[model samples]
Target: MKTIIRNVHKSFGDTKVLHDISLEIEDHEFVVLIGPSGCGKTTLLKIVAGFIPPTDGIVEMDNHVVATSSKSVPPNKRNLSMVFQNFALWPHYDVRKQLLFPLNHHRYISKEIRGSKKERIDEVLEMVGLSEYKHRYPHELSGGQKQRVALARAIAAQPGLMLMDEPLSSLDAHLKQEIRNEIKKISLNVKSSFLYVTHDQSEALSLADKIVVMNKGRIEQVGTPEEIYNFPENPFVARFVGKHNLLNGMWHDDVFVVDGVRWRKDNVSEAFKQKGMIPLRPDELKIVGRGFGNGSGAGLGDGFGGSVEGLPGVINSVYFQGNQYELNVDTKYGELKLFEPLGKWQVGDKVLVGQR
Candidate 1:
């Protein structure tokens, strides 16, 4: 059940889409391909799924060549199941028929197995919590329910590999989160190798066993969620994966100087030093009172009550993020985004920004 993609490249006329992309998905592992729009995540997925042939590369499943530059195995021939962004269920078929269609027509299922199709369908429907809606049509179900049906249908096929292309994108925010969890649970329960594609980093972080971050048709980095978020390999990945306050600066004499303001550098990699960009997450930066002395400015208690050590800045704007206040501060180098617990500071108020 291991899948390997080696030196995969794709081009459309004069435009090149994928560039030397290579990755491996282990058995039963959940791997997510995430990046901005048109970054070739979907293109690479199609290549592995046998929908298209790579210009120069080989895609192997368990040492068998499924696709290569010379030829490609057809999609239906591959023992793979795909769940699309749009619930690609038949409009005329009920949930039961939709779940049973694949089993009825699949060549892999023998006559002996065909007799248990109803039991298998029941098991999958129960896995996705759609047993009660087995008789309903696609139009009669809600967005989440339809997605669950789609998932149940895919699981019922019991393919070794599951390819999900933005399967939860069409749902609303709450439903998206709910279905995202369901997808994770289903993957764990079914133990199928999942290659999911999405632009949402949150989905990647929350769902994937390994995340492949792509940019401009090339992979930027691949690692666990903590590694991608805490120690990004490049500037693009640092900014793309999370809410980062990027400070453009030069590093010399073991110090980072930005707009004539110097700060002691820590937790920065040597590679990032060459790139001249420092990324600090939103939770890393904190807000304190304006003045140095007690009672001289807003008498904010605790950390803000005493003298704070940080770079000087003015609050430019404040945005409410439900749990915390996101403050956009105008610093000497550039604008920095930080979060605060209280919304007491107004625009144009001078403040100090420090890392936690």
Candidate 2:
């Protein structure tokens, strides 16, 4: 389904939640709406799902208007299926019955699928790896298994579009990754366009063919995962999508000067330069050596007297991961974080921070 949302705006009484939102989801494309909570991501998804009408916009599916401000199509009338944040499985229904209900009674179920209901159920169950759990009730399943059932149920209808609202938010870290991979594979095998919503960056990055980043009821930017992560259009996207340290600085043409040090802004957006700030990812910085952080060579070099060519800061905190050390340092730019493989630094140690 090629869905288009144009001039979408939502409001409740005096508070406005969405502002002139517009985007497109291509057929069989996996588009993710990613933003923090209360940013209107779920609200937008509900609008597309026909749960709510937009206050002032039009929703078109394949060039036909399905929703407008005054009139809207019911969800069941649309060729789409939805998976909610919770499992939303019926307690009384076993897995097979759960999959059976949709095939027996959905408006959008194809006649071919309806005739071969049992085969369709088996195929979807195997795709989600829940073939053996067909007779199991919701109470008899693990959280991951329950989620798999939910996914299988959504896919069984064979809708042209699948809407998922944070389907992995309720799972453990390991299960989240496991189910995420399943979702990607299933999306491909089913040949259904996915309009998924999530606040998890990893899920959005790993799954989206295109990512729409929203903030304060407006779109900050729209791009692929690499474009959104490595080339944010604005400061909000930079800070929200990745672990970045926004350095307060001045831009002189291609040069960015911060705390008496100058760096080149290679391909950084003009939006950042206009705001007099630059976002440097944690990996973009390195701990060069120990220094006094006072712009003098008094206490510099490898605990010896030498000149330091980078910003000076004191280590504020240190966290040990299996492969690297996450260190927070207090520089004039503010507290910034950087990761290094060496565990030789401790809190309160003054060090020079340089760009990689």
Candidate 3:
């Protein structure tokens, strides 16, 4: 059930959308395509779903060329299912009928699965936590329930690959979090390859086994969730994938000099050094007590209690983020952003910004 996309490019009139996009989805792997709007993530998903053909390159499914520039095997023939942002369910059918349609009609459904359509529907409904809502129609279901039905229908066919295009975008924040957990569990239990598309960094980070970071019609980086979040390959990935403040610095061997303070470059990618920049995550920063000389060699500490030699900055704004406080500080170098647990910090408070 491995899918390979090779040199795929898409264009409309003279406007190019995707550029030499190449990716691979392994069996039972959850791969997420993530980028900002107009970054060609959706266009790439559409090409793989057979809704549109690539202008150049081929898509292979298990060694079989399913799509090429000249032609494409239609979506139905490709043995894959897609779930869209708008829960594309039939208005006339109840939840049970929605699941039964694919199980009885899909080409990929095996005889064993098709013969036991009633049991499969029950199993799928239970899997999506919609077992109690099987008798309800689209209008009778909430947005979350409607999406569960969509998910159930997609899986009822037992397709080898599932393509999802921002399926959780329309739901509210609380519902989004709830369904996201369900999606993760289902993706694992079903053992189906999932190629999901979304712009939300949290969803990508939480749901993906491998993340494909795309920007401006090109792939920025591809790695596991930990690798992509910690060791970004480029400036675009560093800024887009996580909450990082890019710092201008000079790398001297393994030590990085920024704002008159030298720090060791621990596990930072080489791209930062080449670009004369470093990415500092919020957790990597700390608020220090205002004392000591500006360029003293006092190393950064856990917080205001230890060493105080660091970049002098004034707190600009503070945001309460549940368990932590996100602070924006204005410094001589630039504005620095960092997070701290509930503290007595307020706007216009003078503090020294340091790295942990």
Candidate 4:
């Protein structure tokens, strides 16, 4: 493991923030820690970067124990670079000077290493695709470009690991995705492990080799994007990672009973009977004409007196997203929302639904 955390816990005053957090990150892997606000993702990243000491636990990089019960190495000695949400670039320095300021301040580069500093500056500038703007001040660049400069500075040090705390969250969505690709390319080129922290699920899903999903200051689920999305271990994960409809169901001879209706299994039949869930996705539901084309069931089973047909629902709201129209349907399953292509969808239209 390039980076390892064992039994890490943190508390501020009486409130505990991170609880027994432990994870292993392989060298060169871009791993992301994702969760909602106040989940301690940023705190965990800081612990690895040696910005703040862990209350209790072990932090090791390359099998060298950096922080433990008694000893805490300062950030400079740990051989890591960190990029924050706010661009910590110096206002007084131009791009070229800002990138080299770290080595000059830390005095980490010896006379022998100093000979290559100019080429190193050029190398990292090109690495971040900012060779053309090496002379521009940070204030002259756009939000995404400033971040690139910050990234260039971090990479110029050529640390073994990089810690990012929502570095792209400040950019607009389109620019965020573009910079995200640049980040991915940079990680591949450097082959440096990244401990990324973000609340945005899309960012995490697109960048991470493995995602460590956090919730309320604890590790909830850790896996590849597909595993986290498809086989979520519990309700919190099922709802948090993607779109889902939560419905209560009872097991009845391998079938599930919801709202006094039995749902037959689409897969092989088995003997199961207990209280569980039936996750019905919106795309799984179909709209039958006459509000009644029962050609196939919706994504899930459990249609009540409507005879497993599309239940009647009114359009409570309509939102036009770029690629699709998000419809808020007021139905028996509560006010459920679904997305479809933009069209003549009124707020008072009677609609039918089906499942597949």
Evaluate residue 187 in candidate 3 and report its C-alpha lDDT on the 0 to 100 scale: 93
Quality of model 2 by C-alpha lDDT: 0.89
* TM-score per model over all chains: 0.91, 0.95, 0.95, 0.85
Q: Model 2, clash count?
A: 0
Compared with the true structure, model 4 gives a TM-score of 0.85
Candidate 1 residue-wise lDDT, 1-356, digit = tens: 78999999999998999999999999999999999999999999999989999999999987799999999999888878889899899999999999898797654455654889988888888888888998999999998999999888877777778999999999999999998999988888875799999999899999999999999999999999888988888888888996777787788866776645455656677777887877788888887556322222222333544644566678889888788898998876678888888657688877777667
RMSD (CA, Å), each prediction: 3.7, 1.9, 2.2, 4.5
Instruction: Score each candidate by Cα lDDT.
Output: 0.84, 0.89, 0.88, 0.76
Error of 3 at 193 (Å): 0.4
Ranking by lDDT: 2, 3, 1, 4
lDDT score of residue 222 within candidate 4: 94
What lDDT tens digits, residue by residue, belong to model 4 across residues 178-237? 999998888888856888998887888888899998999899889998777655665666
RMSD of 2: 1.9
- What stretches of model 2 exceed 4 Å from their correct place? 296-308
Per model, how many backbone clashes are there?
A: 0, 0, 0, 9
Top lDDT prediction, candidate number: 2
**After aligning candidate 1 to the native by TM-score, how far in Å is the CA of 305 from where it should be?**
7.9
